[model samples]
Target chain A: MNSFLTAFFAGTSQGAIYALVSLGLVLVWRGAGVVNFAQMGQAMFTTYIASQLIQNEYSYWSAFVIALISGALLGALVDLGIMRPLSSRKNSLLLNSQSMRTTIPVIASLGILGVLKALAGIFWAGEERGFPAPVPTTGLRLGNTDLAITGFDLFVIGVVFLTLVLTTIFFTRTGMGLAMRASALNPEVTRLSGIRVGSVRTLSWAISGTASSLAGLLVTPKTNLSPNTLDLLLIVGFTAAVVGGLTSLAGSVLGGFILGYVIAFVNVYSAPENVFLAILIFLLLALFLRPQGILGSKEVRRV
Target chain B: MLKVSNLVTEFASIKALNDISFQAKPGRITTVIGANGAGKSTLLRTISGLERPTSGSITWFDEELTDKSVEAIVRSGVAQVPEGHAVISQLSVAENIELGGLFRKRQARGDLEIATKDVYELFPILFERRREPAGSLSGGERQMLAISRALVARPKLLLLDEPSLGLAPLISAQIISIVDELCKSTGLTVLLVEQNANTALAVADHGILLALGKVVADLPAKELIADSALRAAYLGY
Candidate 1:
């Protein structure tokens, strides 16, 4: 029972990290109508920036802030420099009749992933490095048993929850946030209504970048960091996003927690080596049951 | 007043708006009536800056609007209520309406409230259901929401594309009458694009007939309506 409790705590902690990364993916999906496969690359790169700053004796918060800003800039640059051109090309005469609208942006995002990975390799090489937890790592005692969740784990969960709350408020209450949401739904109508959807798209990417950087920073303390440290997390996050319904932010968070618990329980009951296979089976079952995702709206076919 | 001259908008190899030229005078509704392929929507799109014209000039109150951004065009008192009553279905009807005024400097929430109240005056049904998601609104209500949203910005020139696109004849007539009343009361200039020629011309003061991206005739609404042969040939009346 204690072991089960321990796994549950461990799963929730890990799930918190997945939620952060999943939120970033969901943001990009909503804003740009493109599933950004490059999220892991962006996260890895920004975390490295944070690591370098910390190595140079900068305070953790300062390093984190700087890394986040760098991530935002990187995301904006990717959208402006790479995604925009590809999008324009997709609309060009030769490609107008082509039915690969979804695939084109995806290919562009993959190119971004490659570029970020190469950049990280060139700058920092392929060394695995440990980053110290910003908060206390000592586990909370549960009736004399050392539980898996530490103070830092609690902090991560709190931060993820806080981020979700803030983003919810942003989209629901603020003007710009509403504009971003509306633009995601229909860019043409948004532009006609006097919103500069281009700027909104760029801003959405920047927000996603900042969230990804935060996710990277939070996850690195728990695991060793390398050039491709976040690749697995990216896949998990993508799965979570899919589980939550690709278009729904709240759904993504729920998906992440569900995935986290699944992995945790699986680790307890089955061989650790079977974790990936278990997750795949679970995802397959979920998708087979509900193709649009558990929380996704029914696809409205427009006339 | 809105003036568009020699506007040529091309999509790939096809010219959607071929040397289109027309004027929308202040305090009048100019209905651009055409068949589906006649470039009526394209003409409005070009003026609203959604589609760039290959060659032409659009002036709004003596200010050149060619090559300007959509937001810039809106700031210059042009607002487009796009085809299909394009309300942001996820947003509340009020939020969708407030989005109409987003081009202006960030107004206080109180100002937004007042602007919304004015729109409510125009669309009382929307006021009752302002808190609901726009998608929940009935088709006619959606059209009302769309028009009132554009009116929230209080623009000098209103560009409405296919306002009657998907509504029933009764609902379409209701929407047009409301628009005509709003135009008469506010002295607002309107450029209405429609495939529903009879209804559009009935409300409009001036009419321009379009055929395959070119102007077939530009005349007073009454004269155009009275011309039975022109109506039979182009409008299928």
Candidate 2:
């Protein structure tokens, strides 16, 4: 139980980070019917921006706020500049629009990764950059051994949890949230209901971007900084979503933590060469069993 | 009053509406009864701005309504209950009603909430099942919810596509009774599209018949219902 508690605490913090990314994934997928494969790239770029600001001696709140705003703006930009136009083409099937929207984001994300890599160099020599811890580096002592949970981890957990709670309330309680839900089910019906379907879709993108940025910024300090940070983090995040089920928020978060623990456990037991096996196992599980994950519900294809 | 002149529409190679023309008067119900491919849905979709007519003008109260978007048309006081029970499936019954009032920027919540309570008072079963998912609702229940959603918007002009599409006679009568009750209120215009010719004419003050996207007959509801030739040719009575 002691070992379990320690492992739980460690992975839960990491899961919170995954929860942030998963939340974004769920929002975009639910609202727009697209599987956003490049969520990590978006997050990686935002994380780079946060690190740059913090290293320049900007206030912590200012840095986080900048990242959040940029994240949301990027989300809206993607919808307005890319997805919305494709959707407006009257006869585009739902699947085609979804694929088109998702593919553009993937390509754009790859481009963004390259641009960020170059920008990171221009701004501060584009080299492997270091991250400033959002919180002070002090591990809580538990029975005199280093429990390895830092203040930053706690802050990440707390912020991510709050965001999820607030979002759940917004979706269930507010008028906008209800409209957003309606927009998800049927865009044409929502339009007939007198709601602007495009606006709701754009709002989803903005939200997805902001949440992804939050994930990137929170985890940046705990890991090495590079263009691929978000790219790698995204694979874990997507694994969490896939393992938990694509459209389930709760499943994504739970998947994130579950994946985190598996990886962390494997890192302790198996040689680094065999670590890729754990990820392969996660992907396989998503393909075979519980693909809709613990928190997710599966949608059937009409034959 | 509503007037549609030379309204033409196409879906790729097929012409959905071929120079369609008709009129619907205020304080009365106009019925458009037709076969499946007779352009009933297309006419309404064009008039309501969901589909753009290839050519011609749709004027409502002397206002040009051709080529406007769905939102613009709705904001201009035209509301529609779409075909095939287009109720937002994941939304709650109450939220469905709430959407009707979303356009009323000036109205306070007091009357609207009371109106919601009134819908519940009128349909107790719906109120009882208000918290449940709209998807799980019966066919008649979904129809009731869709019409109630439209009624909540408090539109001067209401367009209902197949209000009695799929339901038992009993449930159909219940919803039609609610729509009929609205007739007592002055200045309310409705364009009800249905295949149930008897019911459509029974509740309507005036009825218009469409065949092959053209107005085949336009007369008082009772007069058209009484016309055996028109009934057999278009109404399918």
Candidate 3:
């Protein structure tokens, strides 16, 4: 029974990190109409910055904050420097096809991932390093019994919940949030309403970057940090997003928990190698049974 | 007044607006009527800065609006209700109205609540359905919501493109009459574009008839309405 409880707590904490990463992916997809395949690369680069700061004797908290800010600036720069210029050249022969117009930007993002990974390798010499958790990792005690969840696990859950609440409020209660939603729905019409669509898009990327940075800071303590450290998390986060329906934020959270529990139970009962196979099966099931996602709205045909 | 001179817009080798020149006087309804391919929509797009003019200039009350961005033109007090009542479907009707006043100058933003209330008064149906998603509204209600959204910005000049499209005749007449009433009472400058010639001409102070990306006739509304030969040649009515 203790073992079962431990696995459950373990799954919940890990799932929270996946939820944060998935949330970032959904934000960029909704706000900019791109899948953002390079999200983990961006996160990895920022995590390295945090790692460097820690090695230089900087406090973890201050380094964490700086890494988030750097992530935001980098995200804005990516949009302004690459995506904007690419989208502006409408007369290019390579972008003539409707499919190509969508495909090219995705390809560009993959290229960005490669460049970031290469840069990280050069700067850090592809070193694997340990990250310190702010809170204690030992299990908490309830009377004489030790609970399966640690102080760090509790912190992860608390941060993820707070982030979700804050994000929800921003979207529902703020003017800029409304503008972002409006831009996502119909950018041209939003522009006509005197809102700067480009700025709103850049802001979306910034917010997305912050989310990714938060995930990196939280998850790195569980594993070693390297240029390729976040690559697996990206895949798991994407599966979570696909399960939740890419269009719905809350759905992403739910999807993350589902995958987290699945991973935990599989590890407890079966070989660890089956984890990837289980995830693949889950993704294929989601695609085949509900392509719009568990919470995604079906495309309504208005005659 | 809005003055567009020698305006030319091209899409590939085809000229969408070729050397188009016209003047829309302030505080009046100047309707541009044409057939499907007559470039009526493109003219509004160019004036609103959604599309760049290949040549010539567009000036509004001595302000050169030729090279400004869409947001800049909108901030300069010109608002457009694009064709097909392009409301943000996922947003509530009230949110859509609020979006219009979002980027208004700091001083003007104080009037948002009053402006919203006024639009509610103008279209009580929208008020009743303010919290509902805009996509759920009927076609006529959506058009009303679109106009209310543009009005919330307190634009001095309104470029309404095909407000009557896909609407029943009764609803269409009601929408146009409301616009006509607003123009007269508020002294708002209106450049109305429509394919429905008779309805537009009846409500307009002046009219411009277009064909194949060129203006064929520009005259007082009544004169253009009475000119059977010119109407037959271009408008097919």
Candidate 4:
């Protein structure tokens, strides 16, 4: 029972990190209708910047900010340089078919991922370095036992929740955010409404970059930093997004928590070697049974 | 004033607009009425920069607008309400309306409030259901939301494509009257493209009849309505 409690708390804390990464995936999906597999590459690249800055004895928060900004710039560049040129309005119409529209971006993103991975290898050189935790890792004592949750864990939870709140406010309260939503829904109408859909799409990618950077910063401290350190997390993040309904923001967070606990419990009760299999089984079940996800609306009829 | 000379647009191998030329005078409703394949919507789209022309020029207020992007054209006071009553179905009615003035951020808050108030006055039901998703509105209400959204931008040239499509007669009349009122009250120029020739000519100050991607007639609204020979030959009235 004590072991169960420990796993539960640990799962929730780790789930917070996954939520941040999954939320970024969901945002980019809603904005551009593509599952950006290059997100992990972006996160890993930015985290290296933060790790390098921290190693130079800079303040942790300052390093974090710099990393986030760098990530945003990189994301914007990716959209402008790669996605825009490949998927212009004319080309999309020519492509016509829905499968072609999605497939082209997925392929482009894979190429981007390969390039980023190569760049990371050249700079970081396959080294795994430990990251300094911004907050203390001391655990809380509950009754007769020390809970596995630490101050750092609590900080991750707090930051993730705060990010979600701020994201919600930006979408609901700001005009630019509303324009972004409109652009995603119907680009032609949004263009007629005077919004530069291209610029809005670039901005959405920037925000996604910042978010992925944040997830990298939070998660790197719990594990050693490496170029491909986030590869597994990216797969998990995609799973979370699918579980939450790919289009929903809040649903991704819920998916993260659900995934976190399930993985933790599996790790505890079952052979640790079977953890990956357990997650894959859960994902397949979710996709087959509940494709729209927990909070996703039914697909509306396209006029 | 808006002028088009020798404008041509093609979609793949098809000529959607072929060497079209006309002028839309300020503060008046100029209706383009045609059959389904006559390229009425294509004309509006080319002027607004959604569809690129293969040849010729479009001048708005003596300024060349042929090469401008859709956003730039809109910022320069051209706005379009596309066919099928397009709305951001995921967003609330109020948010959809708010998007209309997205480019004019310097006056967005103040202008949005005033414009929203005006829209509510123009269509009170939209105000009552401002918080509801735009998809939930009835077809007539969605048409009203599309028009109201375009109004929020306070555009000088409003390109309305088939506002009367897919609506009952009474509701269509209400929309036309509101548009007529807007032209009179605000001095707003409108380029209305419609398949409903009879209703379109009744409200228009001037009419252009398009046939097979070319203009067949450019006459005063009264003349187009009264010319039974021309009407029978083309308009099917």
Top-lDDT candidate index: 3
Those runs of model 3 whose alpha carbons end farther than 4 Å from true positions after fitting are A298-303, B105-107
- In TM-score terms, candidate 3 sits at 0.97
What's the C-alpha lDDT at position B155 in model 1? 84
Q: Give interface RMSD, every candidate, in order.
A: 3.7, 4.2, 3.6, 3.2
- Per-residue lDDT tens digits of candidate 2, residues A1-303? 555665666677878887778778878888887666656666666777877787788987898899999999878887797667655665656535656655765565556556656665666564566777767867777686776677877888899889889887887787788778777767787787678888998999999999998888888777777766666677777777787777666677677878778766676556546656888877896678765566555332100
Give lDDT: candidate 1, residue A277: 98
Q: RMSD to native for every prediction?
A: 2.5, 3.3, 2.1, 2.4
Per candidate, native contacts kept equal: 0.74, 0.56, 0.76, 0.80
lDDT of 3 by residue, A171-276 (tens): 8788888898888778888999999899999999999889998899999999879989999998999999989998777788788888888888787777689999
Model 1, A162-242: lDDT tens per residue? 888888898878888878878888787788778888889999899999988888988888788998889999999889989
In model 3, which residue pairs have backbone atoms overlapping below 3 Å? none
Compute DockQ for each candidate against the true complex.
0.59, 0.51, 0.61, 0.62
Higher-lDDT candidate of 3 and 4: 3
- TM-score, B chain, candidate 3? 0.98
**Model 4 CAPRI rating:** medium
- In model 2, what is the error at residue A251, expressed in angstroms? 2.7
Give the lowest summed-lDDT range of ten residues in model 2 chain B. B100-109
Which window of 10 residues has the lowest lDDT sum in candidate 2 chain A?
Answer: A294-303
Candidate 1 off by > 4 Å: A90-101, A142-145, A298-303, B105-111
TM-score to native of every candidate shown: 0.94, 0.91, 0.97, 0.95
After superposition, candidate 2 runs with Cα above 4 Å error: A1-3, A89-125, A142-145, A271-273, A298-303, B103-107, B235-237
Cα error, candidate 3, residue B148 (Å): 1.1
